[model samples]
Target: MIFRQIKLPPMLGYLLIGMAIGPHALGVIPSSEEASHLAEFGVVFLMFTLGLEFNLAKLSAMRHIVLGLGLAQVLSMLALVGSAALLLGLSWQVGLALGAAMAMSSTAMVSKLLTDRNELQTPHGQNAFGILLFQDLAVVPFLIMIPVLGQPAEQLTSSLGFAALKIIVVLTLLLWLGQKLMRPWFNLVARQHSSELFMLNILLITLGIAWLTELAGLSLALGAFLAGMLIAETEYRYQVEDDIRPFRDLLLGLFFVIVGMNLNFAILLDQWPLICVLVLILGPIKVMIITALARLFGNSAGAAWRTGFALGQGGEFAFVLLALAAGEQIIPPAINQSTVAAIIVSMLITPFLIQHSDKLVLRLASSEWMNLATNLHQIAVRSMANTGHVILCGYGRSGQSLGRILHSEHINFFALDLDPEKVREAGAAGESVVYGDAAKREVLIAAGLMRARALIVTYAETHSAMKILEMVHQIRPELPVIVRTQDDSDIDLLKNAGAAEVVAEIMEGSLMLASHTMMLLGVPLNKVVRRIREVREARYQLIRGFYRGTHEESDESDRQQPRLHSVQLTQNAHAIGYQIGELGLNELHIEVRSIRRKNQPSIQPDEQFQLQNGDVIVLLGVPENLAAAEMLLLQGNR
Candidate 1:
């Protein structure tokens, strides 16, 4: 909770909490074999989740990055680090183990950070994710190999060969037969109409396969991962994922805590100098290697640098691999302690490194500034002649709907989206959309922030929305920005951040559902509409008094709906100098919504309020009544 409040990874907090309570520190929690074994289930569930997410189509699409860039990164890191270990006089086994551990980067941390920064769709972010995916697959082989390496040198080759054959046969059987039986078995369970039964069946499949692999002398996590992969092919994958998340997270937290308990403060302090050296070299070396590989794979210099910075840190799997290596006696206790300490330090600094990487790239990579300029230039070109146009921060479903409406009303709009494919396809269809990050001030400015009448953030992510709002308010304070949210939870926060209106999708959706349900239930349409209006007025202050649009006039039903119409009084208008009471708009069934004067906010005017020339009186009524009221205001006859 504390980490979440501070926006840091909860895994880091779990480790710290474990350190404070473990035997090495305050000793509130004693070291026990049973606890360690229990925590290992966390890794099992973690692998299971990883397997569930392994979609064949997704892998095929990213095969180049995952196979090319990801494969090269792991191999290069292993070779380079292994060579370094050999020069330092470590045994071959130790070198291999160390290389494997360092080759892995924290998938959990990097993924969460990318999502929070809304960069997962960017080139660097996608490349980082691909690398992380391959690293995760790489861990399984190391899990199998590290243990086999611990055998006597004479028995090692035979043991490795036997292990390999066993793994092959087991995996082939599970995958080939599991896919055939999984769907039918799940169907049988689901037909029972019992969630508990479905859940139990899933658990049974996960653990039963895990136990089988253990019996075959393989890692429990490997079997669990296989189980997940089989289930991924089934229609029940999403449901199983949702059901298994709680177990995965709890066990994963416990796993990290146990890893942390292994940290000896005394060992760390004694070997602080060595640990510091490892920390300093580890991240920089990985960054250089991955950066070069990314560039070689055709990523732009800036994106390549970002990918490198993102995956430079040691990962959760490093702890798992390190613990396994320690257990197998591949690494000495002192060396293991120092290496673990270094990894922890590297993880601690990773967030800071990634946060500043863009700035660093701009300073180091001359091409980055050019990239930014080219991007902004495209946006500026699209928006150059568009005055009072809507600037859409995202061009997803919601933005597309809004864009169509705006276009129909003859209102110009320019959209900025990070997805290249979305921009390309939409642009090919003649949309004024450009590929750019809306969170950046320059992108917003290039989209005509100063000239835009309003800005609408269609995406529901609060963090990115907040950043966009910050930049928008900085560039154009008076421009009305409508922010979309999932619920009312962040309405106040967004409004406080200068959003003119925060539209909660949940609220709007519920209102729509209720309205439809009421009409279908034979409730009067007028009553249903009034109910929806009341609910909306209660929730959205700025949205009160529905403003009729020109496009809506073609819909006959819209003519019957209560609408707001603004009448501008000219110098010769009959009602210009008359009082509100004398206008007799009430006889026409019109309600004065507000009075808008030049350079002033709209205000509600009471009866007997005198109207002056140039005052725009907003009247709310049905179309016929509103039209009659307008005639009465202008010509003094209805």
Candidate 2:
């Protein structure tokens, strides 16, 4: 129960457990060569999952920012860091390698933090994810360059061209094959109904593609990620994901722990002063540069700052690249050790840094340049709030279509979506939108719910929707509340909590489906449409009448009519061998609507309907009569 109450993440607990058992502490798992191999698998799985979320269409839509801004940031950072390294007496090849390592940001850490904070679907989050996507893709080129650049007599020009050509060919082939072949194979596996076999195939496909990419002289991570993206395009993607998650999580935890183990605390302590200076200077400088680049590409100032804070820490891939360099004698082992130590410290502090980033930005605003960016952000927010608007929570298919209709009608409304890319796209299309969890009071306040005309929730998660409704009631009970659900069970709860309307999506869908089937069966289209319209209108009127306390007459009518009650048998019930129709239920003022046998579907009861163990019977009668019937039915047991 205490575990249920704590707002802290489960990941934090995992990280703490890892730290406690790490080599620097209890040393339960010693940092060894075998441990390193396990850690590498963690990275592989992490990249694979990341690939699953990559959308080629969406990426194409944001090509200018993702490709252009991403290229600018990566190239500039590489140049700046590499030039500095060269001046510090490092060879040019080593300098370039170090620069490439530093230029990349940690996708795993930043994406997780954003998601945990429910900021992953925000405009800033989209921009950050786009940039990270590019960085992940860039690993391929960087991997190829390392071997050529780290050579003793570096013929850089020839190697660079060859590497570029090779990457283009491999990426093109992967994309083509992934689109043409992978989706069909996944569908075939799904049809088999053997979940274990499907999952096995998923793992094999991911790792096999990754191995192929590595054999082709590209990064294994790039291949794994690409394979994931291919699999994501299929309808069975979520099923595959559900199966692979346990493996992905366990391996990724090992990766982080191994990262911690690689830190040389003694060397870190010896160079603490230098390391502190570098972290303080480089971290903010890199973030500022990237953030500025984001702003230049048309992101809001707040979004830019968010992207900066998210990507401020060094990425895990940097360690991989640095290790490669050290192995090839391109960089001194001490340099690699120091860089890894710095990265670990930076990552550890990042969560705190982000949590308090707003205050830090205000302090930094004293600078003239920073103040300019801050002012621009204020303008952006003002521009977004040209008029008071309704706030719509949840942008799934129904919500999205409703939003589109709202847009066509020229309504001023803001949307809050859980999916980062959707929110980003909405913002890009000039809609007033924010990414956030609607259940949180702070998130609601941030979205300006109190000032909005209405709150519409279009998702089917009952608890969160109810929570939002309660919060809205507490703040402004008069505000109109509209919600959509998939079941009738929550109707009373939502109504009591003050929702003005609760449209059942499943019921509506089923009704529509029935109408279409009727039309296909040769019913006149006009008659079919009229019947559907009448049914829908009647439902609306019924609900409205019920809420207005005018449904007492209807309730009396229902009481006058016979009612139904159900009794499901438990394993220990004494009536297992009894036959329902043979028990003379008619004499007891009861009727069976249906009976279900073990491992079989429910069917209408016949005279021969046997009530074996675990059978559930549906009976109909008036309340008092039903109670008497039940008592008589259980008389023999008592």
Candidate 3:
């Protein structure tokens, strides 16, 4: 919870907590086979989830990165690290196991960090994920191969051949036969309409397959993965994944904890120098290999560096492989301790390294600086003519909706989005959107922030919204900025940060639900409207005086609740040639908040501003008084 509160992955906290309480430290929890066995299910479920999410369409799209770049990265790392292990005086078997383990980078950590940084759509981010996908697939073979390598020297080749044949036979049967039966079986389960039964059936299938593989002298995780792949072919895949997620996450966390519990600080301390050496070598060597491979694969130097930096750390799967090697006595105790320690250290430092990656890239590659400038230049070019336009911080669904509405209203808008695909598709449709990070001051400036009439943050991510808000506050303090939030939790925080209005979706959704319920229940429409108005008036300052109260209310003050009405001036309108001050609207308890002119930007008119024909004046007052104000403006003294 603390880690999540601080926006860090809970897996890190799990590891640290496990290390503290395990036998090597305070010994609050004794190390035991039972706990380890229970924790291994986490790995099983993780593999299952991976298989469930796997799809041919996605794989085919990323074939080059996955096959070409990913294959190169794994092979290069294995060869490099294996050679290094030999130099350290380890046996060939141990070296091979170590190579496979070190070749893996943390999928959980890198992917989570990339998403949080909103870089998942960047070129480097895509490359990193593609490579990580291959690494995940590679774990299956390593799981099978490690035990074979641990066999006696004379038996190793035969054992490997036998394992390969077993894997092929088992996989073929499960995938082929299971696909035929899976859909019908799922259909039967769905017809029952019992969630409990459905959940039980899913559990049965996953564990039953896992048990089969274990009985066949293969890893239990291998069977679970196979089970997932079979189910993925059926329409029930998403339902199965949803039902299995809690179990997967819980087990995965426990698995990480068990990994932490296995750490022998005494052994780690004894091998401190070697541990340090491995940690120092592991990250830099992996980074260099991945960077070189990425560049060779036709990526920019900037993208290559980012991908390398992102995947340089050891992964959660590395721990799994290391444990397997240790169990088979393939790696000595001292080497296992040092390698695990080094990997943990690498994982711990990965977030910081990734966070500073762009800066590091700019420093290391001159081309990166040029790339950033070019991006900003493109954004500037898009927004150069858009004075008094609305700057949209995100171009997702919410931003897209706002962009369409703005466009329909003849309001110019420039949107910045990180998702390259979204930008491309939306731009092809002639949207006034571009690919940029609105959180950066330069991007905001290039989006015409200084000339913008209003800015709206459509995404509900508070971290990104806050950054944009901070930059906007610094650059354009007077600009009216509206922020969207998921709930009321951050409403005050955003409002205090200079937002003109903070729209909480939850609050708005609840209000809408309440209004619909009231109307459906036969409550008077006027009463429902007044109830919604009261709620809005209390929550939003800008909305406080915009809605008129019900006239049937007993209290005079209730009837006098303010309302908003917009009146378009005709050529013969009495107020067409008059300055706002000369209209004497104040005497009628009316206020002109803004005036929208055709083919021109809306403005908050001052006293000296003269009204023009076809101007839509937004007026605020009681309904009765607003009627008089409209008559006075449209005709003359009425």
Please name the candidate that would achieve the greatest TM-score relative to the true structure: 1
The lDDT values for all models are 0.87, 0.70, 0.86
Ranking by lDDT: 1, 3, 2
Two-way TM-score contest, 2 vs 3, winner: 3
lDDT of 2 at 194: 92
**Number of clashes in every candidate structure?**
1, 1, 1
List clashing residue pairs in candidate 1.
106-315
Give candidate 1's whole-model lDDT: 0.87
Model 3 CA deviation exceeding 4 Å by range: 507-538, 548-638
lDDT per residue, candidate 2, 1-638, as tens digits? 23124533333344455556767667787778888776677767777887776777978987886798878888877888778777888778877887788888878678766765656666678888888878877765676788677654656687677768877898899889779998788878878989788878988988888898888876677678778888888887777777788888888767666665655556667777657755763488788988898889887666677778878777777766776676567877667767766666676667777777656655554453464455344433633564456678887787778888888867777677767677779779876665566776756766666567678998776666777877876665546678888888887677666665688977898898989899889998777866776677576532322222222456676565565555555555555567775677787666766553433444567877666645556566668777766654555321
lDDT of 3 at 499: 69
Clash count (model 1, backbone only): 1
lDDT of 3: 0.86
Q: Please identify model 1 stretches exceeding 4 Å from their true place.
A: 547-638
List model 1 lDDT by residue over 365-391, tens digit each: 899999999988988988899998989
| Residue 627 Cα positional deviation in candidate 3, in Å, after optimal superposition | 24
Residue 240 displacement (Å), model 1: 1.1
